[model samples]
Target chain A: MLEEVVSGGGSLIIIDDINCCGRSLLKCFLAAAAHKGDSIHILNFDIPKDELRAGMDSEVAERLVFHDGFMDPLNWNGEAVLPASPFTLKELRVCIGADASPVTLVLDSLSWILLHNPVSAVCHTFQHFQRQAKSTGLNVRQIIGLLHGDLHKPAVVDSVCCLASTVVTVTQAPSSEAQGTAVVLQRRKSRKIVRATEYFTILEHFALKSLGQHQPLMKLAGEKEETPAAETDPAANLTFNLRLSEEERRAKERVLLPYHLSAEVKSSLLQSHAGVAKIYYEPDAADDVDEEDPDDDLDV
Target chain B: MFAAGGSMASSSFRRKVGGGLAVIPGTRASVHNGQLLVSTGASSLDSVIGGGLAVGTLLLIEEDKYNMYSNLLLKYFIAEGVVSGHDLFVASAEEDPSSILQELPAPLLDDFHKNNLDKEEKTTGDLQKSMKIAWRYQNLPKLEVTPAARSRFGHHYDLSKAMSSEMLQAVRCHTFFLPTECGSAICCSMGHAYTLLLQSIHRVIQQEGFDGSCPQKKHKNILRIVLQSLGSVLWGDDICCSDHPQYIHSLTRFLHALRGLLRMSLSACVISLPAHLIQNKAILSRVRNLSDTVVGLESFIGSARETNALYKDYHGLFHVYQCPRLNSLLCDVSGTKDLAFKLQRKQFTIEIVIHVELQGVLRNCLHLPPDLSDRASRSSKQDLSECSKVLNAGCAAMTAGRTHLDF
Candidate 1:
């Protein structure tokens, strides 16, 4: 789902679970980002550099420059930098690559950075990153930032989401402990958020495979049969709890009076009004025949 | 029986009876030529917004939960433009509008071809007669002797298949992909998005050799301006949050200016806004008031009770909360404004239904038992007499006061 957008050159922010699946997802993403021939830079804050390096094969590791963010005062893997508190955007830029030849920088964990720095600072850093990534000269291809949702405030997560062009949240399955979790991808297209959900399992060699083919859980034949039955009986699933008597229903129908019965009285009244007014000394023929007529000359 | 006339005759009779009460003239819907009624792709949507969308009007669609459905409607608007050969101006502050256009689904040609085959079976002489009548129908109002057959513009699209590039090529789409970066800060500011939008449209109008000064050209080709999503994070201002104090002012100003721009040109605008993201009902209501028409799409698929009650097979509830009354010339065409939409593979259907109110109305109208009815009747009579007595007492008091004043 993300291949088209990520490859096309944009920034993406992935908010994942605290479980190991998130780390596995990052590894898989790095491998994919590297295969695209982008100059890869990994800022590893949660896991040790050695652990991440040992986990991946030399082919993948050789393609990535891992920045150690866990260490106090943050070592840049032997790179020189005038250290600023909580890592300034200028210093981060030097680490990403001074001469950007289609660079893809992966911030493996953002919650660690947020723990030390304010959300506004992190937001500004990302703002600067997007500016660089989108520029024509820098040719900074993609910036993939990973964050753990369990460790950060939702406000922080949302602030980061606002800065990136695409946001992916890897939600763990409630019941399935062994099976992979749901990978919900939301991309900002034409100022609209287009969402697509898929399930992913991390495989050996730091590769990710989608769990199932994109097909409905139920067969098409069953759906066609079920729809007609439901359509014919809209109340098939509804249960009526309010009880009403037959006389009550009749009275109700009478009060809510059908238009046909009411229209007759209106039509006659309108036609009579439209004609000349007349003083009727006797009853009209339209009057009920069963009723007795009263005398007209009563003085009382 | 005096009820000799069926619905047709009864309707005419009623019209005569109510003629004195008729404050507004009867405006019968005509064909594509004279009136500026552009179809919004979906026939139900057309019905919802009166006969069809009026030129020089703005339609604001408030999106439901995820916004994908509203986006589909936007696509339908563009597809309608493409099929009708209207020039499209799509402005976005995020992704490329052209790429989004590429993602529009193709129309279902199977039904179209079948209808064409049926049309071909009609004799050429009959076709010529109909054609001659169609030309006359546009110029004149419906004569009492004959019924006027309404001609509809635009096609019903099938979103199951990929949109063919051939059809896309025929549409003239102008896209303004506003960058979110600060280097183009002046241009891409969400606060200035509406200004930039107006400028782009102004440029288009000027470039097309259309007179922007006259501001009253009623008969010209239609221009479609689509703003994909407003008030989203991607279209953020210098400050990122969408709820900045200036955001509302900027948006309302944009809509007002856009409406003014539309008035002079032969153009209609469709905008999709994420109400969920804005999360402010006051601002949302203001936005609704700013546009000519407002439609809301609410999905109840996630709720079990709501699903089981009536909307099990339906996609969502399509609400026509407001329809523009332009000089009272256009009558509300949709017999039932509120509808339930069901999107199938081939075509989507919007049906009218009243599910939740049946029980409520039934309770109100139910009759009492015999004993209860007797009691109710006696009480009502007593209540009426008591109310009249009170009124007489009040009248007497007023008369006494008048007499004292006279003295």
Candidate 2:
């Protein structure tokens, strides 16, 4: 669906958390857009400027616009400076209207706004932004909202969902041990696409890399073979005790191959050469092989 | 008589009265020969240790962000030995040997392959002929080597003879690359690949009877066990040691076992410990006691005075904090703080600053709903009550608190 939107010159609004999934989606979108020379305008609300800068290329840094301010939105204290916007809806309107079109507006996070601002006000502000973006044909407008179990209240989530065209829940998968975050999209009101999960990690500098790029997106084959009891319900309270045996299996496989070979080598050496003598590889052949394989012809 | 939950019968109390040193199980002798060689690849690290890693000693290399450096050093050591005709056995715990082999510098890999081909050329005519026949049998299409054909040719292609033929071929080559298949039912069930590798090396050394009786035999039996990201193994309760009560005991025992079995006059065992473990005094003491010659890599030392102080305090525990370049990589507070107040007195242009900022837009949107606070704290009863009262007082008090927002 995201691919279709981008290809069709439409924008997408992704909502997720900060740790893995949301960061990965944003990274993929940024990488794809940058590679295609499509303009990207990121308006991160949660991540600090330095952190974001550290993660992105200097060229991409040039494309990013950061809005930092003083005063807590919830308390309205003008003294304490916040990392993100402290603007009112009216002020936000002015900022959005002045910005260029065919833009990809990434809120970077909505959870911050919800936590700091009144839910009703945030919803209204989002609706207002949506109307403005629709009027401008901005192509894509993404408002990434991080939702931890402790912070995302149902009522607040519902209000935010109502304002979004599509809702994606980016989360850490149940069994993945790669420090990779996964995303699960739920259209909520729209037609459902296949429930897909993609794994990603936040690389140094807040830049995200998708682990699913080279590997399969999900362990569907393993999941299918396992009994239904193994299929965990995401909404259920997660227990850390749930060990992924497959991960252990993979680790074990990595350790054994060398031992088996060493044994074979040792036994052979003992039998072939006098059992008591040390086996040594004749040295002259290496020099001959070097003479034969030129720099250009080397397989490596 | 220690009774359950009895204060007087506590294990700690018993140790204090006896004044007996804690028996750390897996703690291995740090120096096998007199020298200790800690390999960090960087010159600064080598210098700090007063030289290269001790020959026939076990050196633990900590894991850093760029694991490539450690991997490179492992390959360098192995390649140096292989090319020099020194039989070397490398048992990698964390990564696949195939993958590691693939990542080895191409020229080095070519050298190894060329060396193998060289040895294959030196076999006697009959043995070479038999090897060719074995190779053909091993690589023949599965259908061609059917049970009926095997039975018919059983006299000519004896299974044991064929197997031994391949083994002989591998042994003739000094540089044998064994990619560990750790998870196979037989090995993994017994222990993790690292432990198994250690055990195998121990067995070989024992079989060879290299009890330091012959220095040449001892040097030739040197095996480099690379347990990458040992932090992963140490964190999980994968280490097993019988006599010692503590985790450190098991770790030290494992190391000692390797030291004795490998006949390592000088062997380097690289183990990466989690940042958290560095804080534990017991753990530090254990690691300190385990190695007679210690060299810390990537340590943060604030000033010469502080560093001197640490040396003065833990003089017997460590030899040197070496690798001042390590200070540059110390990003965490423990690294910084330990160096600043505990180790060094010189303030090398220390510029510490804190930046606090708020996030998201502020709006007085349709004042908080009457039930807003109540709804928010519905998850807990006590919170629900507090929220109800707050909600009833509608916008009674609004204070700024750190709240992480996710959208």
Q: RMSD for all candidates, in order, please.
A: 18.2, 33.4
Task: Give stretches of model 1 more than 4 Å off.
Answer: A1-13, A16-21, A28-39, A43-54, A67-105, A110-144, A150-300, B1-35, B105-152, B161-171, B180-190, B206-219, B238-248, B300-309, B328-338, B354-407
The candidate that achieves the highest DockQ relative to the unseen native structure: 1
In candidate 1, position B402 carries an lDDT of 22
TM-score of every model versus the real structure: 0.58, 0.30
Q: Tens-digit lDDT track for model 1 on B288-340? A: 89888898887653333232434567777788877876756664555554477
Among the candidates, what TM-score does chain A have in each? 0.63, 0.52
Kindly list the per-residue Cα lDDT of model 2 for residues A1-300, writing each as its tens digit: 434333323224455544434555566566555545545555455665566556567666666655543123333555433334443444454454454434555565666665675443454445444444455554444443344423565434543453354454565555555454444333322122233455555555444454553233334334232242466677577656555498887887677543244535544643534456766787772233435434422222
For model 2, state the Cα shift of residue B151 in Å.
52
Worst 10 residues of 2 chain A by lDDT: A185-194
Model 2 error, position A88 (Å): 51
lDDT of 2: 0.39
Residue B106's lDDT within candidate 1 is 75
**For residues A133-198, could you state the per-residue lDDT of candidate 1 as single tens digits?**
455355667777788877765544665675577776776654553345544445455334454555
Clashing pairs in 1: none
